[model samples]
Target: MTTESDVAYAHQPGGLLKGKVAVITGVGAAGTIGAVTAAIFVQEGARVLAADISGAQKETALSLGPAAAPFQVDITREEDVEAMFAHAVETFGRVDILVNVAGNPGGRRGPEVTVEEFESLTSVHLLGTLLTNKHAVRVMAPAGGGAIVNFSSAASFNIDERISMAYSAAKSGVNSLTKSVAVLHGAQGIRANAVAPGFTLSKKNHRVPPEAMKELGGKAALGRPGQPEEQAHVAAFLTSDRASFVTGVVVPVDGGWSARLA
Candidate 1:
């Protein structure tokens, strides 16, 4: 079995985000996408506040070195969300980027889904995105500009037996929310975009059998599952000045999984 320590982050830093400050949510586990993104952000010359509901966030942030700090936050709560940004400002002095990568997997199908399940999914994915963006804009708007990257999923556009209906609907809502933020905040130099990842081998999927992983990954045009770092690289770029002209669009980091017709 592959272990979290076995994962390698080989990307060389080029100072893409030099001197910038970022607030990244969902950074709890060591090898998860959120943690990897936090590492990459620090590697690219940005100070990061790694926020998550889990207490493990403290250690995860420490592992990234001095450029990173940890903040415990429940995105579903408005008070926690507000405190999160305030903490970021106090730690890093300013916020230039906000990446919402925190989410829960949906296993229930349409018929199997309950009202509670639906609300739970929407609360975390949709409502959480709204709260983060709202507070992020509050800080970014006055700072003259900032970048926001919200996580969406391939399930938002493609039907998969493994994905729940509520998850798809919530992700769809995230896309619309992303666009709305871009339209309303673009004038203020605040750029909002979404990344729709497909079949990524995050920490939660490490337990999946190799055969099963191959079968699922083979469905994608790349014939392989994506790594958290692959997704992180794109996120880093989107938040950097390199993507100054990019905004209001959902980029699929799915290795062509969403592009396949069959």
Candidate 2:
């Protein structure tokens, strides 16, 4: 469970995520938020299982060392979610953290939106969140405790001209789901929180032109796009001991964009 590298990145000599076991979905190629977060977790003494629907998962896992494992799981499927949690328990003995990052852009226009568009986004963002937390809590409650961090989007709170209607609604639902889990499960020693990220560039969603990107960054008080590591740090903190009393909170890792609008 422990590895040589996991000891190095701790905030303290024995850092926050030490001895923890985390399963992060949507870990893609290097330079991604999920990839950076997984490395940070392992470096801080957590055994990490990085799951992605992509075939690149094996390559991503190999670089993180023996303490890190990768599983190809489709968050849209209940069986895949079940198998993912099972794989974590099988590999590391138990699950300490569950981070839900598997989401898609519901790209249809509002007038053209189909039931499928709504369902696709809901399946990944809403149902996926429910399935992962359900199985994770099942194990965590009996075993004493655990933490979960689900990804919501700042678009849910702030109207984005770029993202579609379904994407916004789906993320808004995730925010609601986060609170429900936390409210229902807190006494059982299960803590659930959410991270609402601003427009951070990803391989798939970085479609904005350079001029627009600059304009968007300037809209934030920080006047810049958020780095993936910035969000990773927040994710790491929410799952850490320092956040022991934190649950049902949706922390915006938005570079103050939400407040800028205010």
Candidate 3:
């Protein structure tokens, strides 16, 4: 029985992810990286479980039609995480890709930050990464291995006025976590990697003035803000068989902003 997760391969012409099953979190925003990735994955013939903390994922899945299924999930809770994967297995029979895209960039700068504030971002960015990978690795190990794509950020290492120290530190830990999973589970055929996006614009955050975006974009070597699709395309490559020999690296899709010196 073909499910929504893998049924895309039947109707879609692309076979990049033909017959693959994936659980994608943080697809609540229509133009966010997660949503774009889910759309591309489905286009390439993968069945997707589009999950998020909000009801927006339902709309995204509905818009994407049968290729995507929506699951409301909060990554901070262990029970929610477990149920997310269980549902994926129940619907798809087996999982081949897990894209953990839910994370927050909020926190304090300098010495004024509170512990509670730090934990808030860390819980979403760091703890969420660990919980999803932990569960995903377990499931993939028995299924002859799989691929995991976690969201990192250019702020992880590159200091910038817009970056909160907590966000950077948490994302840095995510990159490290990626490496550990790659090596520890390498023998099991599980490949782990991260995509670090820089200055990506989304329709959900229209509150930011266009001028501010231009200023931020000016900091990058490419002199422009990145579209969500650009980042998603990179993620698609990582999760697809095209990157079969690639694993354990944190790729920067930052438009050269990472290379520029402030």
Candidate 4:
């Protein structure tokens, strides 16, 4: 697999994010969007603070380099989210970007789904994102401004086919938050945007049978699902100065899956 380092970036400078400080959430496991984004930011010369609810985040952040630090945080908890931002400021001096990528995957609801199940999904995806973004906005306001790149999903716009109703609703909430932040904070120098991905190749989805991957790709207009790096590339651009004029938009990195015929 050709890495980002191997490919020379032509759109902006070679290191688009040099001297920037970034805080990325939802990096519990390796190869996830959060983990991948953290690595990409590091590679692009940005210091990263990777946080997650799980402890595995330490290993993931450590793998990146000294500039990457890991913290255990639950975005649903305000204290934890606050601490995450404070930790970033204390360690990196200041924060310039935030990638709200922390979320759960097991949103499949059964006929007898409990309230706890519904709340669990909502709190993790929607509420958690709000909390993190809220703090990021507060911390960034006094610092002039910053960039916030959120993770949405194609499920927010159409049927998930996977039938994660709670997840879809939560992600839709995320889209709203993204736009709201962009509109309200652009005057303050903050650029907020989202990336909606469909069937990306991640640690979770890679477990699906190979034939299933092929089937998923066949459903998309691009004849393929997606790669984590492909999605991360878009994220990097959104958070970088190259996207200085882009805000309040949810760009789909789903290989046209969002545009397929129903």
Candidate 5:
């Protein structure tokens, strides 16, 4: 027998992200950075739209209870991107925050990387970000404000032999777009920022052999890999009131990995 009190208790406003709507794309599988970020947002009382290209978003939203919405979106496509924002507005009434997390490893390297390589990486990281922010600003500008966090990579700084040229180039574009958006829209009450992560360990890459792990850790000043939660925590602050004065900034969530390399 569900009662009104039970319903009231569930909707109770809790600070940190109370009454905020966060649309996070990239939560496909468990133990990924995307899932960790979504959990952190849910913990702080933000209604989430766990958008991903895979069916796994349904399960991710289920774990967060009723406040979360799930959508399958191919960020490379315009219609899919539009539908994602529409669903968020329909379900949560407004989008107070946007997290662009969909990214590909961009492969090791290609014998002869062509325009397709550039298009694939650019579409997901740069164009997807632009489109998401485009829709967010349309909705939030009139409402007076919003926050956006786009993901770059520590690869943006380093000349890593391991990363493909396209991936690195695309992320640099993401960083640039973040700053440009902030500069143009700051006066409108909207804030834009970026996070560049180092060789953060995740289910996908953690299966490397112990020696490889040691080599990877050595790349960071911390002498260890970074956790996804660490990045998520920084993201939470960047998108929250705590960072009200922050905009047009490229924050490095790397484990001092860039510094060590420098």
Candidate 6:
């Protein structure tokens, strides 16, 4: 049911990521940033392993053509994360890039936020980033270096009532972890960075009423919410060799929302 138009983005691929093998997480849904990123990566001539916790990723990957393959993985699990990278290596020969986009939303705040809720969000966002980055380093270091793009959030940089303390804290941890990887592995030729996106009209946000969504998006200086492709384009740039000197940085693809907060 996913037509080309459903996942289309304005892109003229000039092999920005040519001859690379990438593993992208959270690529299950058709209209998600992850899925769109996979499509763009393929268009840029990178073979991709489109991974997610959902079986839908199989179909999502298939839609991107023969250069993409799907793998089901729970990024929070060490075994699953290991297998994910292993599968990528087995399928594509090596991992030249990793884009960790799998994450759950967090909204509970104040004293009402339960311990379980905090743990769940941290496990998925923070711990998941840790595990993926750990394994990716294992692959990249041995292979003479690679690039990693971890998905953070605008919540990490600003105080937003719409975001939970746990989510913000986890993403903050992601920023630190990303910096640690860059500092520790830069000499090994590995580059690690993060993308912090603002309110985006991804499939998950479609449930919000149009009026409410418009109000939320209005918070950005751009007066609009971002699109999945907008975020994907940045990820591709960071993962590509064009960004060879860019590492340990958290780029905000928030339509000047963070600047507005500043």
Q: Model 1 segments beyond 4 Å from truth?
A: 1-13
Error of 4 at 113 (Å): 4.1
Cα shift from native, residue 197, model 6 (Å): 0.2
Please, what are the lDDT tens digits per residue for candidate 4 over residues 1-262?
Answer: 1124423442556787888899999887788878988888899999999999889899999898898999999999999999999999999999899999888865455455567777998898888888999999999988988899999988888885565777788889999999999999888889899999888888888788988789887767889878888888898888887777789999988888889777
lDDT of 1: 0.90
Per-residue CA lDDT of candidate 2, range 134-185, in tens?
9888878888778899989888886776678888988888999899999999
Model 5 steric clash total: 0
Candidate 2 least-lDDT 10 residues = 1-10
Residue 146 lDDT (model 3): 90
Q: Rate the local accuracy (lDDT) of all candidates.
A: 0.90, 0.84, 0.87, 0.86, 0.83, 0.90
Give the clashing residue pairs of candidate 4, or none.
none
Model 3 Cα lDDT, one tens digit per residue, 1-262: 2234443443444578877999999998688778988999898789999999988999998888887899999899889999999999998888999999887766468777789879899899888999999999989999888999999999886778667888888999999999999999988989999999988876655567888878988878999888888888888879877777689999999899899777
Per-residue lDDT tens digits for candidate 1, residues 10-51, read 133478888889999999888889999999999989999999
Ranking by lDDT: 1, 6, 3, 4, 2, 5
Please give, for residues 1-262, the per-residue lDDT of candidate 5 as tens digits: 1135533543444556666899998888887788889999999879999999988999988998998989999887888888998899999899889888888878756455577877888888889888887877877788778888998998887667667888988899999989988999888888999889887876687887889788877788888888899888878778876567789988887778888635
Pitting candidate 4 against candidate 5, the one with the higher lDDT is: 4
**Which of the two, 1 or 4, has more lDDT?**
1
- All candidates' TM-scores? 0.94, 0.91, 0.92, 0.92, 0.91, 0.93
> Clashing residue pairs in candidate 6, if any?
none
Model 3 lDDT-worst window of ten: 1-10
- Model 4 alpha-carbon drift over 4 Å, by segment: 1-12, 109-113
Q: What is the lDDT of residue 241 in candidate 3?
A: 71
